[model samples]
Target: MIPPATPSPSAPKPSRQRQIGGLEFILLMGLLQALQALAVDSMLPALGTMAVDLGARDPNQRQLVVGIFLICSGLGCLLPGTLADRYGRRPVLITCLTSYILCSTACALVTNFDQLLVLRAILGVACAGLMVLPAAIIRDRHEGDAMARLQSTVGIVFMVVPMIAPSVGQAVLLVASWRWIFGVMALLGSLILFWMATRLPETLRPEFKQPIAPRKLAMTMGAIITTRSAAGYVLGMALIQGAMFGYINSSQQLVAEHFGAGARFPLIFAGMAACMACSNFTNSRIVEKFGARRVSHTALLIYIGTSALQFYIASQPNETLWEFVPMMTVNMCLLGFLGSNFTSIALQPFARSAGAAASAQSFIRMVLASCLGSMVGQAFDGTARPLAFALMVAGLGCLVLVLFSEKGRLFRRLLPPGTPRPIA
Candidate 1:
């Protein structure tokens, strides 16, 4: 099979004014992407409530609420790409968003833990479109370092949602039960759906459309698996995300139970998230100057170092919150520098199959990361040791994957012929 042709230097650019303006496009895509984060982070403060109300036998079992959603979301991601390629991005997205809204509402009414888990799984599937489609939309218009810059910009804005979600959840909990969290999610989903329906244009070009054939889909997915850069980066991303999810799954317990920060959980959580957001903003500004690979590689080393320090701190007797929070915050901030760059590199190979490519990437990252994270979370022994060790291990694994992906090269910029390098 022939590889898809790379867009030429002289190729016509899509008009930003024809569809949506640049700033509005970024904001819409950022908010759309943030829904997934909002769903996960906003519920952190309520995990204990959920466990108690749902009659969970083990405190750790509460994590399944987050883990199952990620797993099912990964499962859901497998199909939207093929569907978006065959149909149009707008239709597939709208349908999925509607399903997400309904699922969120259903979650608010579930009476038992099992019932809630089932709904959350379905919600994950519905949200799969939201996670995969927006990136495809960006790919529909941009590529290479330009795409990297836009992705980092979106990350900068998108990080704000996670920064505030815990506070939002806590606020809801102050007046109502945890059920209201889902209700608020539903409302937010509806607003995004409406905004998308009104403003988002069909970004996919007609010539790039693919038919929904089994053989064709298989070949495309196989291509993704066999492509060295894409596969390596995807695996590397999954490992890094595994570390992030470990922190997310255990954050509330770490802050409240381990450090006695129960009343200040939201504030502390928000502060950590703010660190990540600031890092993303910084990356957006500098990625163009230093290139995505260089920036991401540098950040990965820092991440590994920070993780090692965090593990040592967690291993000590009577570790202070001061020691743990700062190290973890720095580790998370490094992640902000890595996520978009890794994704841009992985998606660099696809043109016509952007949706399928995005789907496959999301599927692997979410599913594998969720499993690793769940393991770390369940190993909680009334200390931060498990989480810290898991991160350090994950960081080492991620470095190896990156090495393999780049063929043992690190911090090098390789731009395609005629592709413009980012300027300072």
Candidate 2:
């Protein structure tokens, strides 16, 4: 069993301050992460309209808006955590939020496709800190199954934004131009920033603040990559998420254009997303009882099974909307069970370097997922086969990674004696 490293002995420990309440902490972290989701999901319904307005000659090119944001966000993830480790989480997060707000408003004012894509890239980079720092903060207080439960709870809240985001985009299109979608994004970002500034306290422990020397950074990266469980889960989760990203990139195309769900796209999208939110809620309730390894390992197998079914159906000539939707929804449901638990397990051995660890893992995951997602998105053939096949392949790859991480072991809970217990 991999054990988390203890706090550095050389660094001086600081006195703890009053931390935020449990419920509010979960809510704030969820919303901060949700900002990243809101930006992407909310843009889906408007992709077609924006494509035309921005003079995108090819429909697939419109997807670049999403793909570029995601890839740049991955690239952006490389720095913030290391900086946060040296400086502090709160100040770095504030700077990121400010930049995100500014870039979002700029995106609203873009007059051409090129201009909009450039702004989207910047927006994504700014938002990477939102994704990286929250995990670090959560790790500051919890570890192992307890951390997994908190993550699942935060995920339940985060899933709410995705459930309604496409509809939010659709609503904006009905009343005003698509640009107003970015306006809404900026407004929401502002509110979250305010809440964070006023309520959230610094969670990074004093002893963890080591100097940002090249040798130290290299050692940290080396530790993360060489650690068996950490590397395996990080790569495994990325493969599966890459499959999900493929779906996100193609959902508007496959559902609206291919399946004849044009007008009802938002409703259909919301329905699938609701499945995820429900799964997250269930995970938060049961993860502590069943254990992160047991639940996630079981879910990973089920995900592979569901993906295989989806692929088989997609290969058939007479596939219908009803047939495809059910299998896809099952896969989405399994994701909520897999994501937080995989993350917790991967980061379990890095308590002292949570920021650097989270940052490195997130960078690898996001870059790989975005590139793989873009490939899947570009592979759309006016059919669901590409997506179905990608999902199946992703699941198999994840299984292989997990096997390597555990040295062929599965479903074994390896908690050390004094790991933090689940928060009430």
Candidate 3:
């Protein structure tokens, strides 16, 4: 039976400070988010060279190289959040980053396609930890509006890495071999490890640290599945994420080979990344006025809308590169807007179990996105049309999921602080 009415005097005081220094938290968010994008997109510019070097007979298999890594990454995302719940976020993050660094090095060293695939799988496992811990850390200190603002700040920081990552990969490939990409990743992983070791603190209080025993883990997973509100928003986020994977995986090949842009493909990719960064920055500014749910919901509509237009454009004959690039950039920016806000909404409901919640979210997102991205990559035809079609379909599906999740409208009073009032 429900307990008798508790007096207002008996209610525990709400703590004002929920997280660490704002800038530090933002950087932390950036590094962790960077790993997810870097692990997949960093190798994009080199996919062609990678295929030739590894002597792969099938051209489509090139995308598999990226897809396989993501599959493992998605699988890896499963454990870290819960482990962070049990062991504390710092230790779990360190361990995962260490494992990722080693796996990334292995990616560089692998001589065979099978070996490379296995290494990518291993990298995926390591990435799970890095992917979820930051979200938990954010939850440790803030909720509702405060959480939204902090996350938006982090999103701005997180935005830059993915935008420039492919361009960076392309630039790297000019002076180095494909293996060196892994070497660079090794360096990134090491730096992130060192940074965490020195700067990161344990955010889950002693009273909150749960044991990693199988029973407890199972219980936590069950609770998450039962949390309908949390589940709905993340599903929407996952679809949006899958769309990104579809584009990044196919972009370099589509531009360099299909469009004959050659070395200029990096520049084209950079242009898109720049636009995404701008979108993230814009979200941070307007999130307070428009609210995360309203912004994200509207952005998803735009995201899908832009993709629909792009699809129609793709079907037309003799479309110039100039025609396609503008629309694609717009589509990715739409993604940037939705990415952070949707995630913030997903994480809003579970302040106490941020670590496990973050992990579950990451696992679902990465797994779904990886599978979809891989399929899109394998489906790539000589023209840009297939990529456009995949994006449109993903965008449309994401919209449906969001609508169903929210029951055909947006949520009211989305959280952490400085969260703008809801628009709809």
The model with the greatest lDDT is 2
| Per-candidate local distance difference test | 0.84, 0.86, 0.76
Instruction: For candidate 2, report its TM-score.
Output: 0.86
Query: Which residue pairs clash in candidate 1?
Result: none
User: 1-424, model 2: which lDDT tens digit per residue?
Assistant: 2223233333233335434657888899999999999999999989988999989988888888899999998989877777787888889999999998999899898889999999999889888889888877777767666676677677778879888999999999999999999999999999999988877877676667757776766677788789997898999999999889988988889988888888698998999999888887788789889899999999999999999989999999968888988899999999989998998899899989775676677778889999899899989898999999999999999999999998999999887789987789
Q: What value of lDDT does candidate 3 attain over all alpha carbons? A: 0.76
The lDDT of model 2 is: 0.86
Please give the RMSD to the true structure for each candidate, in Å: 5.8, 5.8, 7.2
Winner of 1 and 2 under lDDT: 2
User: Which sections of candidate 1 miss by over 4 Å?
Assistant: 1-24, 138-153, 201-208, 347-355, 415-424
Estimate, for each residue in 1-424, the C-alpha lDDT of model 3 and write its tens digit: 2112222232223235433354665787678877877887778889889888888888878887778878887887667766777787778888888888898888888887878888787777777666667767776766666665676567667667766777778878889888998899999889878777776667777677776676755666666556766666777677667767877777777777877788788778877888888887888789879888889888877877888888898899987788888998898888778887887777777888665566667677778887888788778877878888888887788777777657677645446578786699
Worst 10 residues of 3 by lDDT: 1-10
